[model samples]
Structure formats: C-alpha cells, structure tokens
Target: LEPLAEAGVDAVVLGCTHYPLLRPVIETVGARMFPSGLTLADGAEATAAELATLLTERELRGAGPGGLEMLVTDLPDRFAEVASRFLGEDVEGLAVKQVDL
Candidate 1:
C-alpha cells in the first residue's frame, strides 16, 4: 500500500496461485490504490477456454500417432528439463515452426 501509494500504480497483478485464494485481501488493497487484481487461476482458466475454442475451430483435438505438436517462443538449451511436464520424454526435439496471427 505504501509503495503503490508512493509509486502511484493504478493496477497490479497477484502472480502466485495462492494469492487469488486471498482474493478479498488483494481486492481490498487494490481498491485502495488500484482498479483490479487477478490470480493465476483466473488467467489460466480464461486462456484454457480460449485454447479449447481455437482447437475446436481448427478441428485439432486429441493426440495423433505422432502425438501433440509442441511449439515454443524459443527453444531452451535444456529442452527435456523444461518440456517434461507438458510434452514428456517422448518428444525428443521441437521441430521449429513459425505462425503469424
């Protein structure tokens, strides 16, 4: 509150997943200085919904024999360490592709 009051911020984001669970506290503080605060779950759900719509519109659903296509903003030096959670060990490398919206 003191920092935001000094800095004159009108909005802020609460990044931790648990922070949103304390929405009341966050909202109260934000209301005192900012217009809004959001949790990770809120953004995640909204993004997931959007991705679902994109998949439906593109007729891209379910895994193919080749499995799910992986795309990245940049290929990390440690691909397996990063990709394991979402893509798993099966995907050895990311075949780079570019898409323009």
Candidate 2:
C-alpha cells in the first residue's frame, strides 16, 4: 500500500486469487494513503466473465451440474480450506490433486 501510494498508482489490478479477500482492507488503506482515488480491478471477475462469454460464443456451455477440479503444487489441505471460504461452501469433497511444477 505504501509503495503504491508513493508511486502514485492510478489503479490496482488484483491478480491473485486470495487478493480479492483483502479488497476491502486494501481499498481503505489505499484511499487513506493515496492523494487521489484508486481504482481496483478484480482479475478473477474479469476472467470469469470472459470465460463465460467464450463458452457461450463457442456453444460449449455445460447443460448439467458443473464441477471444480483444484490442482496445486503444494498444500492441498490449506488450499481446500481457503478455496472453501472464497466459494462460500465446503470444498472437502471436491477433487483436489497436488502436482509437481
């Protein structure tokens, strides 16, 4: 926040999945630190919207229940917990796999 404020950033693009969870705090801090207003862009939301559009345009939208597969290089349990919080549901039963990068 301090670095961004010092750099006089006009906008901030949240590129990480976990960053959105801290949006409120980041915005508040940024507002206090920045001389001008700071615009925040959620990459996840944008990505999801674009994916939806592509699926629709390509006629690839699924008709039945959708599924989620989580692949991580490390910490599957922790990832599941955090993902559950973001998804607003339990991810304990979801398909999760850890792979070497």
For each candidate, the alpha-carbon lDDT, in order, equals 0.56, 0.89
Clashing pairs in 2: none
Q: State every prediction's TM-score relative to the real structure.
A: 0.39, 0.84
- Residue-by-residue lDDT tens digits, candidate 2, 57-86: 999999999887889887899888988888
Question: For model 1, what is the alpha-carbon lDDT of residue 67?
Answer: 48
lDDT of 1 at 79: 47
Residue runs of model 1 more than 4 Å from their true location after superposition = 33-42, 61-101
- Tens digit of per-residue lDDT, candidate 1, span 21-58: 56677677656565453222356556779998999889
Q: What is the C-alpha RMSD of each candidate to the true structure, in Å?
A: 7.8, 1.8
> Could you give me the TM-score of model 2 versus the true structure?
0.84
